[model samples]
Target chain A: MITRRLPPWFVNALLVPLASVLCGFVVAGLVVAATGSDPIAAFSSLFQGAFTNQDAFAETLVSTTPYLFLGLGIALGFRAGLFNIGAEGQYYVGGLAGVFLAYSIHGVPGLIEIPLALAAGMLGGFVWSGIAGALKARFGAHEVITTIMLNYVAFLLANYLIDGGLMLAPHVSTPRTPEIDANAQLPIIIAGTRLHFGLILALVAVPLVWFLLQRTTLGFRLRSVGFNPTAARANGMSVGQTLVLSMGISGALAGLAGIVDILGVSHHMTDTVGAGYGFDAIAVALLARSNPWGVLPAALLFGALRNGASFMQLDTQVSSDLISVVQATVIIFVAAPVLVRWIFRLRRQQVAEVQITQREETAAV
Target chain B: MEFLSHQDVVGLLAQTLVTATPLTLAALGGIMCERSGVVNIALEGIMLTGAFVGYAVALATHNVWLGVLAAVVAGMLIATLHAALSVSLMVDQIVSGMVINILAVGITGVFYRNYIESSGLAGPDTLPHWNIPGLSALPVLGRIFFQNQFVTYAMLILIFAVHVVIFKTVWGLRTRACGENPAAAETAGINVYFVRYINVITSGALAGLGGAYFSLQQIGNFLPNMTGGRGFIALAAMIFGKWTPIGAFGASQLFAFSDALGSRLQIANVHIPIQFLGMLPYLVTIVVLAGAMGRAVAPAAVGKPYRRS
Candidate 1:
């Protein structure tokens, strides 16, 4: 079934994603109409809201900052054939660690404090991901169940701390942490918009990840292990160690995503901080086919769609929740590339679509 | 204190059994699907689909059995959809299950909202409780077993039947073969895909029956996400039970007891961070799963697509 005929230049690699986006907008339009609203008018407003003003474009990029980091983190792990579903939990732990380090070590210089907090967050994410890796390597515990269960643990644990132990604002009628010191805050890249140095930091990380993956011995081992652990082990590589390290690196990247939100953007920590970035990152990474460099564009697209959704709702009278439906549909198409191929009558894929699931991918275990 | 007296203990156990009925049945369904080598992660989705269909039919026809029938049929239908996507198309099974789960959540949430907020339909007729004739009057054990709805008894019977069918029959052997090693079984002249297909759909029907218990037996109204990770918990139990039907049944009871205990503790006003206490079952499930680490191996061909390579 491996079709030797390559797809036409236009309907090939780039077109699928473009077509998926068109499919998304069409669905978005219908949803707007179904709500008794004008689709074209709503979309125009959404477009204007997202891009017309400098501030709006900045805001879209601001939101894109975290998605880019987290997407790349998961993307790296995905290339190694590891699914780090615990990215959300890792992000939570990382955010808390970054905020905690910033608040406690106030006297440090700006350069030192900011880097320290990021390191703390990355360390938090690294440790969290390490748990999954150790389980996979030593115990053969499935990451899926462990990851989901750990999410509840991380969330509840973080909730308890914010709600009681580290109550920075107990009288504020909400569970949230105090703001980090001014020295720890990431500077604004734009004069007025919410966009900060985090976007630059995220951009820097993309190329750094690509380089480390493409030109390093460690990256080769990780990819080898991902492609086939048995073969890698036979080739004298430490498969288990590579898995743990890959997981840790994945978590570290995810952790950086959390730090970007708290120190670089929000300037404070709260319960809603992660805000589904972990899950959204999955879509971003998947859309990029786990390519580190590709994640930026995928993330920006998601960022734009999400950024425009509110205006889409307000102006077109579309149910904003349809964004959720559209998002899930994109996930369906990406995860099942066969559907995308079937829809376009694609010549058979050159390579099989990568099976990204960990284990017991079926319902049983 | 009064809730735990020896005499009152029997009553609590009786209530526990009734409460555990659906979870138990659902776990059994979960066990069958897993044993047959299909990751039945869509237990929640299938259960939701069953719940929706059962409620819709019961409301339309006003017949309790018809509602149950519709649920079973609908469950099989959804199962077939899942099977085709996962088993046939060779998509990632986890994503396939997740697709069903998300679709179920979105569809049921939208439809349930429409039904309640806009449809203006009156409530469907619910089943009446049935009591065993002479057995209902005896002491503790008698009351425990005899005083319950028809689904409760049917649940127990069905589980036992699954036990018999799985352990005592040839079909069960073939089904197990598919899960444990499909390629070898196919070489052995067993129709691996056919066996898996039947088992998966049967399990879906079972999940559907478990769902009917929610709408028709437990409550007349359908609430969104009412399955509430019970499907995942059942998955945990299925593995914790070593992929055996009876083992899964016991595991479900253990989880049900945890749920019952959590409720009782909340009512008792135990000041212990109910959060940590509330975290008990999930935490225990985590520990139990970890303990089973490197121990409970999945079917060798659990997620591999058969392409005659």
Candidate 2:
């Protein structure tokens, strides 16, 4: 049988995501066609807009920076068996904190100011997320509900601050904070593009996160708790403490995502700062199967789609909302690998055999 | 500050009912889905689809009931997709629900812009209010309860009816058993899959009715994301109410009261920031969940797909 010859690892790791992505594009094309437009033209222009020139590529990278940080943060939470859905709130609080600090410390040297702002962002996210983590740890309140509630509170807080004169920029009626000082701004990497030092920071995070997850005792404890909390507790691991620590770390990363976007690109905290990156990062993490190393490619893919969407709309008169459709489709396909296998006519693997091996591994552990 | 007059209290109570009706319906729907062992985070998306379809059909057909029927069908279609992915395909329930949400936003937005917006049509007529002659004339109670739109009255009836059905019937027993232990339910000869599918689809239908309330009963027009996280709020309400239909209704009333009060305060020129007022419901939800959720036990099999070995 074809299943006998198939490599299990390739099917599980690579082919599933690839097939899901292809399926997503196909569905998106059909949606475009339904709108009475030429799908081929739409897709061609989407590709062209994403990679046609250095400027466009740079914009894609600019978008990718936040996704990388946010995705890694969410991936970490998933590894620790926590769903930290309040990344949006954390991002908002982080940006607000970073901007507030940067504005207040106006006379500091560049070297000092930059790190201070970034640290403020991380601290803000950590504290914001810690509220939910603490609640979950102490009260057994589900993180999903707490995080979602926190999102609304965060938005309202940001709105209040921006509109009530606390952070509102002088001489402007719009609801936004004052721009960060030049000392706090991240240096641009590309001469004529928005690409900034945030890209380097995001890349640096990848190795650091990878090392922390794969090579540390803390990582082992977190993973063991995630895999089986009862067993981990029996072996002397404190599940509640691990949950709080992992969630705090997750929030810190998301906070960094917010500050990077502000310092690298936006330069000011606005009502729309971090916009949908927190939510989009969930998809990125899911597509990458919550793997830190895989987040780079996944973030890039999402970045390209977002970057290309405006041009797709400009060129074909298609609504940029189509990108959301494609994204949803990808998530559906990826989340249900059985559907992908069935669509591709692949035989089902022996589940009994897999279960026995899993049981054996648990027993050994 | 002057104490609110009797009439003013009645007015606020009436407004609270109007605001709470949609949330009650959606929370009841959430209760049904969760009681059947499915975690339905797609309530927001399902509501959006229902609102869009409900408004579009009402405008096109010039019939509100037909629009409601179409909305329910559209919601069921999305719910079917959710059921297929989460039940048959064994996908992560939360992820499946999130996809449904994103898909609904995209589909509704694209369709509304391409077809509905370009048509240059005005908003549909609002649903008519029903003034029950004898009841509506009966002082403050009458004004608070009887003098409202048809959907508001229907929602009140539904709250009682659903409470009875969920707690007092044999079907309810099997459904609860399925959620608590699907393997045991299967052993007992209950069709667990069928019960889950039916409950989830019915949940979607109720959510669709709630969505129709937004477009038809409240605003007379469908706006993008008009549900505005009400669905999530409803989920919080479900948890807060300990997943009981009547309890969820009570929680919905609490949230709606706060929402109504916030708006009233805004109109009365209160000193508190409007943003802070907007934050009240969410803050209350957090406080309630943290205080009460530790003792709220979820179904053992919730979020887990059952596959017979």
Candidate 3:
């Protein structure tokens, strides 16, 4: 059945996301039009806002930084057959922990203070998500429900701390923590823009995660447990330990995202710090099909939409929420690749897709 | 104990029932969906859609019942999409559910900002409270049980009705068969897809009514994400109840009690931080799931997509 065609990898990796993105835009445009705005004008403004506008591209990269880490975090969890729905909470906890570290310490070199704060954030996320992982491992608790429940708790905890409790800065008009020390903040990489050195850390994370998933025994165990926990257990791998470690690593990445955002951009935590980004990362991971490399473009697309949304709203008077519609549609198409194949009239590659889903079903149970 | 007077008990119980209304309805819906072997984390989104549509329709027509009907239809429509994706298209149910949730938030937010927020029209207001003539006069019991809004009454009745329908009927048996072992059910002449489709859509209808609790019954106007995390809380209640209609009702009451007690403590100027009180339900859910009582197992085939070879 071999025929002259583009490689299956090319189609699955490249063509699929590209077509899904197109379908997402089309669906989003219809929504915009239904809301009595010109979709063309809205999309055009959205593009300009994301790229062509002054320093907009840089800001888009800034947004991409968090999505990059969050997407990678969630994707890693998916690799371990766990759905980490509490990334938002993990992010909040990370910020709380990282910011506490950032402001509490006295004079030190930026180099010395930055890594410590980042580690604190990662530790926070790891601990928070590890609770769910431990529950899942020990008691067979479903991570989905536990993680979501934890998200709400995390939000409340963050709100309590920053709003008027321990972390609140004195003499501030608004409820937010005091600004971090000058040494703790990440230096801006680009002059005249908000882009900071965390982008380098985020960029480094991709290949590092790729290496971790591809070339490491831990990665193999995670993938094996995700593929079939029963078989992995039968093969002498400790499924419980793998689940815990997978969740811990996932949370650590998300924590990295949260702390990076604090050190790089905001420099202080607020109640609304990680509000919707955590949920959006779920879509990002879905779009990436839980592939670490795939997360790059997916996160970038989401970052662009997020960065451009406000400008789109200002220009076309279309609500910024329209971007979520686009994200949703993109994921819908990604999740049902059959629909995409049918729509594009591509050759049916049913076997691989079905096998992947079958494994997912087994893992899900 | 001294601060809790007779009137406070009655008021607290009444508030507990009021808070339980939406959680119970949505949990009942979760029971229907999951019992038929489909995971429906999209209840939150469906409820949000129902709330928005219910409020919008009620606002336009100035008729409350029509709004309730519209919410049900809207929920069913979204569930149909879920069915198409997860059941027919063989998409992962979780991914499909998340998509529906995001779409609901986006669509509802866009519509709410564009039309509802700026309409300047007042909502028809909460569904009329129906007072039981003789029971309404009773000292404490009547106030806590009988006097209520339309949805609360329906919720009370639906709990009993759903309990019977799930446990004591032929359709119930088939649905459980589908959930537990669809392959065996199909071999024995059950249409697995049909049962799942019907149950999932019906769950949407129930959840839609739950949404009306927010917009049409409790508040006159719809707010973006006003369903908040209640839908997720309901899912927690569903698991806490072990996927049974009656059990879900009990779990919803427990959650509602915590919520009511939290507000009560806040009013009473309790020394504990309010955020800690707010964390009670979620923390309770984690504790429950972590096997405080025991592991509450789900339907065997709940999260799996069935395929007939």
- CA lDDT, every prediction? 0.74, 0.82, 0.88
RMSD of each: 4.1, 3.4, 2.1
* Tens digits of lDDT, candidate 1, B67-172: 8899889888888867877777776666666666655665565445434434577767677776778888888867888888867888888878999888899999
Best by DockQ: 3
Deviation in Å, model 2, residue A6 alpha carbon: 3.6
Fnat of each prediction? 0.22, 0.61, 0.74
lDDT of 3 by residue, A1-365 (tens): 23226677777777777888999999999988888878999999999999999999999999999999999999999888888888999999988999999999889888899999999999999999999888888877778878899999999998889874799999888889989998888999999999999989999999999899989999999999988988899999998899899999999999999999999999998887436899999888877878888899889999999999989988877889999899999988887888777776678763136222223323122
Point out where model 3 deviates above 4 Å: A1-4, A350-365, B1-3
TM-score of each: 0.86, 0.95, 0.96
What DockQ does each prediction reach against the true complex?
0.29, 0.53, 0.63
- Report clash pairs, candidate 2: none
Best-to-worst ranking by TM-score: 3, 2, 1
Model 3 pairs whose backbones collide: none
Total backbone collisions for each predicted model? 6, 0, 0
Report interface Cα RMSD per prediction: 3.5, 6.4, 2.6
Better of 1 and 2 by lDDT: 2
